[model samples]
Target: MTDFWDDEQELKKNLMNVSSTIESTVATAHGFIRPILLDHVQSVGKMLRPALILITSALGEQEVTEDAIRVGSILELIHLASLVHDDIIDSAAKRRGKSTVFAKVGAKQAVLAGDFLLAKALMLTSGKERGMDSRVVSRALSRLCESELEQDAGQGDFFISHHTYLRRIAGKTASLFALSCYAGVALQESEPTRQMLCHRIGYCMGMAFQIQDDILDYAGSSSKLGKHTGNDLKCGIPTLPLIYALKQERENGQTQLHDLLYQASTPLKEKTVKQALILVESLGGVQKAQILAESYKKRAFSDIKRLAHPQVERQLSTLFTKLSTRSV
Candidate 1:
């Protein structure tokens, strides 16, 4: 299957289309946080999750339904809204190479903007008071918020276990992704088998996607990621890669790295940070993480065979390959 970059132009075009649709939905100003929120929402991004939802929907039905579009759009809108809030917590200055709403309008304004987006999303999902998916989706959004709050509260706690980190990220990141794909399936079929397959596949894919994100945050640059590199590290969050390295360290490697990490939130010296990174890289942390991600992709794909065949299922299948090797 072709990778994401192999079809980079196609992906970009699809993203632009999704962005345009979302803007049309939420671009109006009720005098509160009008253009500021709109401009930030219009910033360039991959829009990969929504695209997956749509593709998975197509797998079940021959034609796209209005329900599918609305569901896909709402899923993405909620995800983006969460991002707006997350940037505030992380003190992120930029996203998609544009000044973040938090940077542009201050944290207070940014919070309002995020609230506005979320409120708008809720209204749309409510669908003129007869909203189709409001109940399930509202519950999902609440879960996502709780997950993020947990992660935020625990970010600085040195005692948080790896399992805690995994659960937190799964809720914060993978839950939305899972719902995106699950909603697609939900819209088309209520068959237990279909729903089960979609959930399992989406959950595993979400896990892999978040891990790759952790890997890139450390290994990639701002231009490629469209944000500050090592933001997580700087925030004193010992992510999987660093955590893995620390776990696998030789006696001295463990002591030195742990000491460097345990110190309260000072900017890790450049030389010291580089050594830690090198240690992580040497201990097979990056490789091990990739292996775990690949296992998720493999497990996700393994469930695909259980579903009835459709021609467009290929695109859904391609998503696994594309995500595994995507560059940006």
Candidate 2:
């Protein structure tokens, strides 16, 4: 199948615009903070969220406006802020194959930088240039913060339920995605129904994207992932695969893996993490997680089909396939 982005060359151009806009916007930070902000911009991700915003904004309009690029930049800044904060919380040394801000500048500096980026995002959103609803962004940010806290509190709790796990991801990852989709249509004078449909598509796609990311923790190559494999377990978070594996073990009256999973307070050795990963895989955790991820992908496709524009439908279908199958 042709790549989702293959025919959408305009989306690529729009993304370039988004990147340039982000550079200028972030450069406006305090002089002391400019270098750090520019450094973070260097690791700009695949621009997946911004691309979604640009595509949905141009659905039938056939134009990715300046407002769309501006909105996309705001979304990207918010995402970067979250990553900087997450690196500190996770104590991660590297992201996208480079030392994280926290690792280079220490936690205190990283936290202030993250806060600065978040504030800039809000400031851009409220600017007279676009006048977007700050309440929308604020609500998503609130959910993101709350979910991070919930995940932290639930760490090392092996019995974390499937419902709770899903809730956490919806807040942590999917909320921002939903906001991107909403912004896509909300910027234009589109029908309310179309806007709602786009929002649902983003939420479903985000859930699937994050689930696939979690699956990569066990199945992907660390070298290609640009981070250590099984780091999530080392951090004491019982993700979907581990949760399913433990359930399978219990049904079979197994206790060894359960004992290993409960070591939330103790620092996990690399060997222990490897052993736990092995047990989770041997117990069918990977397979179960794949099935769950597929379910979310199916939901996203269903929502995509509801979009009225044939071009939008085809593009979104290709995007869904790419996201579900990509190595990264």
Candidate 3:
């Protein structure tokens, strides 16, 4: 994989700016509020969203601005808030090898902590210094809530439609990515056409990123993943790998896989999850999901190629290449 830092030195420098801004902004909080907010911020995993803002702005041959930093920080806070809430819902024990807030503080406090983060993000985005339109951020947040509720509603079914799955991911993960790049370009470029292009590029990358994550849940190990493999299956969530495997089973006139998954029990046991993982691989679910991810990556590259700056386009292309094959 390409080294993102060595290849894009300038973007990496700007990303440091974003990181500093996040730390300083959160430091303004006092007492109990500081710890709750800083816990995740202090140990973040992959600042992908902010990097997107900086990279997309660079694609327009523009320097990263204060507005970009402000919006990037706000978006990262929102992303962290979503992770906190997701951990609660998934009953996750560890995140990036540390005790999750939900694991340490219990669900009630975790939920409130997540809400506080969202509130802080909202305040920042709405403040006069934010420069960009607040309505866009508001809509993205609403979509995120709706997608979380949709995922909640779909739980325990074991078989979700592809359309439903796509819509859920679009709202849950892709919306913020799209918003980040759009807001980044919004600060530097006035051309509505270019803004829309950046939005599409980010959307494609986010979708590909989530698909890769779901694939890892089936194909990765605890040491590499920083959490137990097959946790999604244990939690009764149907991701793309399981979705594709189930379809193959039905097409092959095989009922054993279906019975093992849906008819065996509720909240799948570890043994059942292991069996499902084996069956998914045996049925080529992993390969199919990989192909799907590649498709989204190609879509992102299509837009990246359309950018006017050849060097910036090459940088983004290389960045996505690293993202596509990332292990964690």
Q: By lDDT, who's the top model here? A: 2
Using lDDT as the yardstick, the better of models 1 and 3 is 3
Over the stretch 1-328, how does candidate 1's per-residue lDDT look in tens digits? 1134355455445555666667877777566467777887776365767776666665554454556666666677888889899988878887867788888888898888888777766666645322125465666677789988887776655445578768877888777777776776666665656765776777888888888888887677668787766667776666777766667774444576666667745345566566667667877777777888888888888876666665335666776777778666
What does candidate 1 score on TM?
A: 0.87
Superior by TM-score: candidate 1 or candidate 2: 2
List lDDT for all candidates, in order: 0.70, 0.82, 0.81
RMSD of candidates 1 onward, in order? 3.5, 2.6, 2.4
lDDT of 3 by residue, 112-155 (tens): 88887777777776466333566866787899999998887777
lDDT of 2 by residue, 1-328 (tens): 1143566787778788888888887888776668877888867767888888877886555354888888888888889998998888788899978888898889999999999888877877646533246676778879999998898776667678888999999999999898888787777757777777888888988998998999989888899889998988887777899889988999999988888766535346888899999999999998999999999888889888888778778877887898899776
Q: Residue 323 error for model 2, in Å?
A: 1.1
Candidate 3, backbone clash total: 0
How many clashes (backbone atoms < 3 Å, residues ≥3 apart in a chain or on different chains) does model 2 have? 0
Candidates sorted by lDDT, best first: 2, 3, 1
Candidate 2, which segments miss by more than 4 Å at Cα? 1-7, 60-64, 127-135, 264-266
